[model samples]
Target: MAGTIQQIAELAGVSRGTVDRALNNRGRINPEVAKKIEQIADEIGYVPKHRKKADDTVKQAGRGKRIGVVTQLSQSSFMLQVNKGIRDASKKLADQGIEVLVKENASVDEAEQMQAITELEEEGIDALAVMPVDCDNVRVKLNELTEEKNIPVVTFNSDIVGTKRYCFVGLNNWQSGQTAAGLMGLMMRGKGKVLVITGYFSNSAGSRRVDGFVEELKKNFPEMDLVGVQSSFDHTDEVEKIIVNAMSAFPDLEGIFVASGGQAGVKKAFDKLDLHKRPYVIIYDLTPKNEKALLEGTVDFLIDQEGYDQGYRALSILSDMLRRGRTPEKEYMYTEINIKTKYNLN
Candidate 1:
């Protein structure tokens, strides 16, 4: 710690009045006295914390943001929901002069995410909000962005450790998935073979949802056998392939779970196979497509996690951190999880 005013005054061989005025820039002190004090402090390597007024002035200068948002991919409804959240959050800060420039990777892979993040940096944004593709590389990238250019970052929807980031805002995925599984187990009376498909195991959110779903099944309804799990990348064609294949392999598959995107595809496969008659279906993300499926009874239950709201919450936290120096201490935020059935889908 730096010496107090008394010590500084004694060391500089000046009175405490001279030391105080010089340090505070009160302009009453002579130039010689101020120079001497500053020289002594520099020689001693003394740097002090900023006072409250000084801190507030600096933070107020950071209020209006020039922001860039990096997303996983643009194909899925889940990403669409998160984008909506960003828009709503930026709009709320519009009168305050904040601006958001959004960009997306074509896929959830290290190369794509790196490309998107790098492009966002080239845009010269003051701060960033991103859904990183890989936890390991993403953390390193974030550290580089912040340390090199002094740009702060916040992660939304997925988490990466070992670097500085502003915040993470997304669904409580495990709990949400567990809730989905529980709903499925209850609807089936805990005595059926269930098949669960996700976007991919590499993606953190999809993996967590699977873990939560399986954990919930184990804890809540062990009798319901979770037959097998597969990956879809949440695409219509890819998801169609998996769901159709799984339906054939698990002929007695009584219940279904789509833990990631591609809910509409799952419903479509079910319709084409005429399998909807037997297997009770539960998929995620209540977008317009899935909402329509819910209305028609093609999808039995839809766990609607509002992606847009997560974006809003994340941006709000990042803005507050940069502008007000307050970080969200809480781990997660609550998103809308609407369990919609055919009758109530409307």
Candidate 2:
């Protein structure tokens, strides 16, 4: 039996990523650690498999291939990191003779996404990566792209149900919500009125987080009263208004959770209110604005969904499929749910 990368990593007491880098000879690692990893692999009868060298495979398979990427909520702060990942991956793929076309949408509108897809299809895209709006039409479009058009599709950041997408690369939104609920529970001492703010109700990512938070709150923090759950549509003004109105409605709101974008609006709301004390706040993303809020003690916690990895991996997965015929090991490639605070901002 051949030893797996996970086994080697476990034996070396290192991360799987480090093991992969050491074995593949891609990326930097401590020389001593790399030596130890190699020794472990040799002792365990590990054999690396590759059809061709990485560069050769990319050059051969990517020569004439094109990939299309469509992302929603383009104006949000979180998207900066995601787009950076896309741009970096695009540069790498371009060097290998592949063209990556990107379409950014400011809102989660099905019609807009459909139009973007149509345009990309007209451009003869070989594969697609999208942060799809959770709607019946978008789901149908994804299915058509994969099944009828013979174009592989990878969904990222947000996903829709009942789609023939090859895979999804992003956070497990439900678990992220549960994490928020636990954090809020701990902050409020398991009892307080809390408000929930979401980016868009139509987005499965946000909705699932809200659902998970609600279920976890009910099960564990029963005394924590949920004042309301409002959608901000990823708009700062909308988020500000929602927070202000919720605060007015629940004067004793003890905690607030923002499950998606518009975190700047949270600080704006705090400033506008100008209260002696503010509600304990939890937000998603590690954008500059959110980091500032945490540093200033406006937010209690920030949950990062690894937006960069979501963008980079989605495109990379599609490229691998088109270039090397490699299917994703998992249908849902969930990124890590990292919790950040001022104490551990790094």
Candidate 3:
């Protein structure tokens, strides 16, 4: 039987990536480990799998080969940055003859997303990258696009669970939320009424973040009172109204966790209340609004999910999958979860 990289790695007790590097004569590896990997390959009569260079495939697929990217442009600055990342990557790949088409929607409407995706498919894109909406209809559409049409789909930023997309490229939203909660608890000294403002309840990412925040608060800060959870739908007005109502209802609220967009609106509401002592605020994303809020003392902490990397990697991974027949080792490729504070603005 011909030996695969995995087989060689197991016999030689090394990682598949190390074995690949040793066999391919690429990357740095210890001489002894490289020799052992080579010997194992020879002992097993290993036949190297024919790998078409991704660059060659991109070149051959040639001019007019297109990748479609769909995301919400008006939702927040974060989404806008994600869009920029996609465009940046597209520019990098343009010289290689691959064109990137972007479809932007102003809101998180499932119908709008579904329509955009369907239109992209109709436009004959070779592959797709999307910031998915968590809805049954949308998931079904993605599944059909991948399973039926054989067109690869990679999701970025927000992910839709139970989809046939190749992989999810984003942060572990639950962990990010937990980190936010911990920061809030620490800032409030572990005891206070807490209110959580979530983005879209239907989306798995938002729900997971809220769930993680609530769970961590309950487990670690039992004294902290969870006032309520409000879905903002990433709308500024909605976030403002919700924050005002929650503050009015819970005057003792000492901490506010903005789990998604609308930080500007939340800041406005906080300003309106004119509390002598404002609630400790923790927001997600390091957008212009959040950055200002952090610097000006409106927001205490910010959790950023490297939006640019998410977009770039999603497109890059899908391109590699189509060009080289490579599958991501894991279903989820999580970006780094970075915590930002006023002292460390960079």
Candidate 4:
């Protein structure tokens, strides 16, 4: 026997009205309670007629809506491309009566991100797109905004796991890490010392990349020595000391995989070493500094996880969701990961 809305409401300790509102995704109900009711419905296999009607209601009322995009946008050229993507999307959607408000933080600060989201919520944004930092507090805040405020969120660049974000727009970071490991192994002939420089450990993307790279090396290139891993926080100035220390400790270091920013500083450190055989350097992104390094033979390869597509598509997806109550067919829309070398610099 198929369960009714009454059954769902009773199981969730809510009223029939609440169950109807939640399952249909209509009306202003507590997001937690709504989530509970929906879960109960799914468990009991209860379907609502209002599902079709809700979409129509949203489509009719959703035009001329405003959206907010919050990101940890720094002065880095990579972030600049992402911002350009957002602006491009905004321009494309202007005729459709959709408005995008982009807000950026200068650094990867979770507190600042939370505050930005809070301000956007207060502004009554129809939806939100965020470059989330993987933190418990940020996830909680995101949940609160989604369930409590009924604003759908899509994460770009970085992700906050175990939350209700509609979807993630980025690369297959783990696979990308494995890709880098493969390149490192080939460049160093599967032997010699390697140093890994990572961004914020709290960033899900960076952590996943590191995990994949390390796991790949452990499985395939057991002979390769992983000399050390240092956190640079993706800042250029902070990376010099870490790189200098590694070079001092492992004078025979044959390669480096910078999983974040600060590649420019790493180059400076190499200049100081002046080794007859420079280490095989592999880094991420197509930033200007990285481009110069690749051309000059300072970096062997670059793993480019397209930033522009992430920013552009995140907003597009969020806008569709806001206007038509449409959910993405897939949970993660992964961008392409291109391996750029000097030969392909053109």
Top candidate (lDDT): 2
Q: What ranking emerges by TM-score with the best candidate at the front?
A: 2, 3, 4, 1
- How high is the lDDT of residue 228 in model 1? 86
Best by TM-score: 2
lDDT of 4: 0.81
TM-score, candidate 4, is: 0.81
Please report, as a residue range, the 10-residue window in candidate 1 with the lowest summed lDDT.
47-56
Per-candidate Cα lDDT values, in order, are 0.73, 0.87, 0.80, 0.81
Give TM per candidate: 0.76, 0.84, 0.81, 0.81
Please write out the lDDT profile of model 1 over residues 40-131, one tens digit for every residue. Answer: 76566554333334345546776445678888767777677677667766654443355677887667888778777788788767788888
In model 2, which residue pairs have backbone atoms overlapping below 3 Å? none
- For model 2, how does the per-residue alpha-carbon lDDT over 292-338 read when each residue is reduced to its tens digit? 99999989899998887788778778877876787887899888999
Model 4 misplacement above 4 A: 1-63
What's model 3's TM-score?
0.81
